[model samples]
Target: MKSLNDIKNIAIILTLAYAGITVTFLTYMATSVRTYNEIITYKEHEINLAFGYLFLIGMFTLVVLLLFLFYRAITISNRLLQQADRASGNYTIVESVELDKERRANEEKMREAKLLFDKEVESKLTAMLIFSPENLAEDTAFLEAIMLKMAKEFSAVQGLAYKYNKTNKAFELAATYAYFSENVKQSFTLDEGIPGQVAVKKESLKINNVPQGYLTVLSGLGKGTPSALYVIPIVVDSETVALLELAFFNNIDELLQQVVEQLEPKLGNIYAKFLK
Candidate 1:
């Protein structure tokens, strides 16, 4: 559990201790020889024997210190290697996590794109079926079916279909779907309301932020006002034959707009047969 700094300090102390011991041993050897030769030539041999033992102890201590220093160095190197391995493992885990997140994001984007493509294809097929040559008719039920289909497909809660009355010179409601209001008007003059304006101009219109009490959608739970309205004029041979009014609770999305535009010409062709 000792830190690297503590180990380094211990090593330095051992090195200094070894140096001091070596210097002391050398000084003792030199002084003992000089003093013994000057004072007692006969005891010189005994002094040499005692100093030899001391030298032997000093050398043993130095060897032990060297072995301990070498062991400490190896232990520190192993600790460093272990730390490096742990760091590398953690880095690899983090990299793998990041790659997983990127892969999930890409998968979500692909799914969204696929859903959009499928919806577009379905809308086109519905348009083709509704405008088929064999299905062309002036029946009120037929007109209502078209209106209901469009309302559901475009997320409109309610819709009304009006056909031009040539003799009366006005637009008369031919069909109504998902409507519960009793006071709904049965007919409109060319200059009367939003539908009337589209009829006179022979153009399509989209209205947002509808005025309060302008129109309401009814269900078993309750009734609520719509936030947006779409008035599409069905023209055939340059003559406005019908006006389709749809009410939605939310703003129309881009995909719905594209589908509606694509249906315009085909709906016109179907309306032309109704004129006959």
Candidate 2:
């Protein structure tokens, strides 16, 4: 179909042509009336003048009618073009929004897949620790190895392993990793403190914002209080057998929690063997 602009142009051209023809015919009639007035009788001249005026009026009316039609056509075509442009703009905006949504969804899926892959790798590694040569020797050696592995994996400044002593009715320190304090508490009964609470509850504990004078981490340059503490109890057959404590300079996050989840079961099974 012809575009609006093309139709408007055609209408404009026709209007100008009709206006030019009207002007020419008006000039010719004026000249003819002058000629008739000079030669003819008064009555005939008056009649011819009336006929000439009527023809001129008819021609002028047709010119005005064409011009009005042309104006309406131009107005209609402009409105149609503006509507088309607005529709096109709206479609583009909708498409852009859809693309943005798709991109965000793809990014989320990729993040979830990476998390799953990392959890799998960590699970396999923690499981393989069961067959390590150092961990195969004895109970204390196994506990020490496990503490060391956990401290390194979680970026802990200090770690301690405590075993429940039936005769003493308390949990006694069995192994330490990166421990620097000589006056650190070595034993606790049920309901004594955080460690004792974990022992009694048989569940893990997480503490944040350790007090200023609480446990300090010693380094070559200086010493500072740890920011976070984790106490996990090892439960086997509905009985709490051992407890693990770790202190960190930073806070733990979801990934660390998942690592603990994977390692805890393996630790419980191996330690159960040691108990046997």
Model 1 bad stretches (over 4 Å): 1-128, 131-137
- Show model 2 residue runs off by greater than 4 Å: 1-131
Best by TM-score: 2
lDDT of 1: 0.76
Residue 38, candidate 2: how far off, in angstroms?
36
TM-score, cand. 2 vs. native: 0.60
Q: Clashes per prediction?
A: 0, 0
Per-residue lDDT of candidate 1, residues 192-276 (tens digit):
9778889888878888888889998878898899998888888888888888888899887666666676677777876676556
Error of 2 at 35 (Å): 36
Worst 10 residues of 1 by lDDT: 128-137
Clashing pairs in 2: none
Best by lDDT: 2
lDDT, candidate 1, at 211: 87
